[model samples]
Target: MLVASNRGPVTYSLADDGTLTSRRGGGGLVSGLSAIGAEADALWVCSALGPGDREAVRRGVGEEGVLMLAIDETVHSDAYNGIANSVLWFVHHMLYQTPLEPVFDAEFRRQWASYESYNRSFAEALADRAAEGAAVLVQDYHLALVPGMLRELRPDLRIGHFSHTPWAPVDYFRMLPDDIAARLLRGLLGADRACFLTHRWAGAFADCCRAVLGEDALATTRIGVHGLGADAGFLRERAHRPDVEERMAALRAQIGPGRRAIVRVDRTELSKNIVRGLHAYRALLATRPQWRERVTHVAFAYPSRQDLAVYRDYTAEVQRVADAINEEYGTPGWTPVVLHVKDDFARSLAAYRLADVALVNPIRDGMNLVAKEVPVVSDAGCALVLSREAGAHEELGEDAITVNPYDVIATAEALHTALTLSPEDRLATSRRLAERATALPPTRWFLDQLEALTAVG
Candidate 1:
């Protein structure tokens, strides 16, 4: 089997002594694949982003039955970020304000050419490496065109594609120029089966294939929903580590007595609604003065895509909002908001363990793993204030206090309710949440998808 994504199994970093060290990836997909390393031969074709990655790729490094192939810098920049993030990301996440006309200009056309070249690179590589009738799994928006391109090269191979983000509604997707939309749908149809994270997303994809590519294509295209879940064993084991304990203790000490923690951990991206979340926290402080000193919001928003101007601007906005809230409501001894814009997985687990309320209110998300992880690792029974738009909400909705990502005042009220619940009620809610969160572990989720694909064959 071959696994392909935009990022590989390990990212390289230069050590203090000038040695190159590779750090394993953290997301559920990486962990799940690692856990099942003995099952099959897996070759991961990913983009080489930096000097370290390029060096490692050139060395033909192989470990844990995983092989890494890195694409060129020009292809990655123009295709991955320019077209995937700036174009398809907006279309799928519904981030654009389309009241203003969206132009498909010369730059977009140039980037589209790069996107095609990038996908062709992967298809060529996979074609060269794949055995006859081997299963090839392509991941996310970054490589949507690979399945079709690969199929053209090697007809005997079984091709599958999975979208890790929401598929846009037909109306929203139509914002793309007619040619681009048609090409994307046709590209995906090259796969024997395509999977989405939720039934809604799956249906949306099927609808796209039907509307854009014609109903005849739908007869051959198989769509499935594989709702991704957290790695429960990994979270549980990490929670028991001494470093996690120490971090939890430090966090508790900082919050002091009689103050509950409202926690959110996210990449510093516009889609996360970080600034709006801060606005809601501020709204809570201003409107409900009684709860001001008793609560602290711990927002750990690590920098992401710092090279992009929009992302840089968004990170700055997050800081400005956090600073403003602290200024308005902070006491000499107590800060109303503790904002850490860094990526520390252990610290994130510690935050999950220490949280009184886990706030996962994304404007849109495929699956907010934080919602699931907090319930599994939380020391006390923590209430989850989840956005209805999150893919996780479909599974955890019965236990979560649902809120719209746009309604700041309503979300604040929900937060207040979660923080003030009685101990018995909190415990009960937490028990149910933990049960739901861990019901489908990552290995089982992956196996189920594999089984479904096998059945399709």
Candidate 2:
């Protein structure tokens, strides 16, 4: 089986001694497939962006089994950032607020051409590596057109695609020019089966295919939902490491006593609703004076998508808000906000363990895994204040306190309620969440997809 995605399984980084070291990826899909190991002769095809990546790819440098392919910069940038991020991502995540007007200019068309070229690159690579009857599973918005392109090239191959983001409703999706939407739908229909993170997202995709591409498309397309879950064993082991313990001790020392920790770990991106989340926290402090100095918000916002101007602006806005909040409500004895903009997995695990309240309020997300992870390994039963917009809401709604991402007052109230929950209630809720988080492990997820693909074949 060949799995195609925008990012590879291992990323190469230059070490202090100028030696390249490969770091394994962390998502549910990666961990799930890794568990399957040699049983599933999985070949992951992904693009490489850096010089080290190019060198590694050219020299055939990587672990024994995985195959890495690096594409040119021009094609990757225009296709990935322009078409995938600017066009498809906006359509799927419902990022655009202005429904009345959308800009589809010459640059968009140019980028769309590059997007097609990028998809073709993957198609050609996969077709070469895959056996005559091998199954090729395509991933996410980045390579939507690859399945169809590959299918056209190799008629005997079985193809499947899974969208890791929410599928926009027909009304919102129709905002894309008719030809663009039709082409994308037709591209995905090249697959024998399609998968979504939730049934709601699946239904939305089906509706789009029906409304945009017609009922005839349904004859070839079968949709399924595989709700992604956390890897309990991996998270549990990482949570108890010495590095995590040292970080936890450092956090405790910094915050001092009688202070509740509200933690949010996210990439600094426009869709994360980070500024709004901080605003809600500020509202909590402003409206409820009692919580002014008693709560500390540990925001672990690492930089993401620095190539785009909008993301850079969003990152600045998050820092500005964090600074403003601290300036408004900080004493020499204790700082109210601790904003760390660097990516540190150990530090994140430490934060997860120490979190008294986990705030995962995204504007829209396929599934916020942090919502699941915090409850599983939290020292004190962490209260989750989740956004209704997150895809994880379907599975963890009962135990979580759901909030509207845009409503600052409601989010503030929810935070207050979460912080004030009794110890027994918190523990019970956390226990339920931990059970739900681990109910569907990663190996089960991959096998279920394999089963669906096999049934269709």
Q: Which candidate is the best by lDDT?
A: 2
lDDT of each: 0.85, 0.87
Model 2 RMSD vs true structure = 1.8
lDDT of 2 by residue, 100-192 (tens): 546988988888999999999999999988987888889999999988899999978889999999889999999888998998988898998
Over 4 Å off in model 1, which ranges?
A: 14-18, 35-39, 62-64, 99-101
Which residue runs of candidate 2 sit more than 4 Å off their true CA positions?
Answer: 14-19, 97-101
TM-score of each: 0.96, 0.96
**lDDT for model 1, on a 0 to 1 scale?**
0.85
**What TM-score, to 2 decimals, does candidate 2 have?**
0.96
lDDT of 1 at 5: 85
Residue 207 lDDT in candidate 1: 81
RMSD of each: 1.7, 1.8
TM-score of 1: 0.96
Q: Which residue window of length 10 is worst by lDDT in model 1? A: 60-69
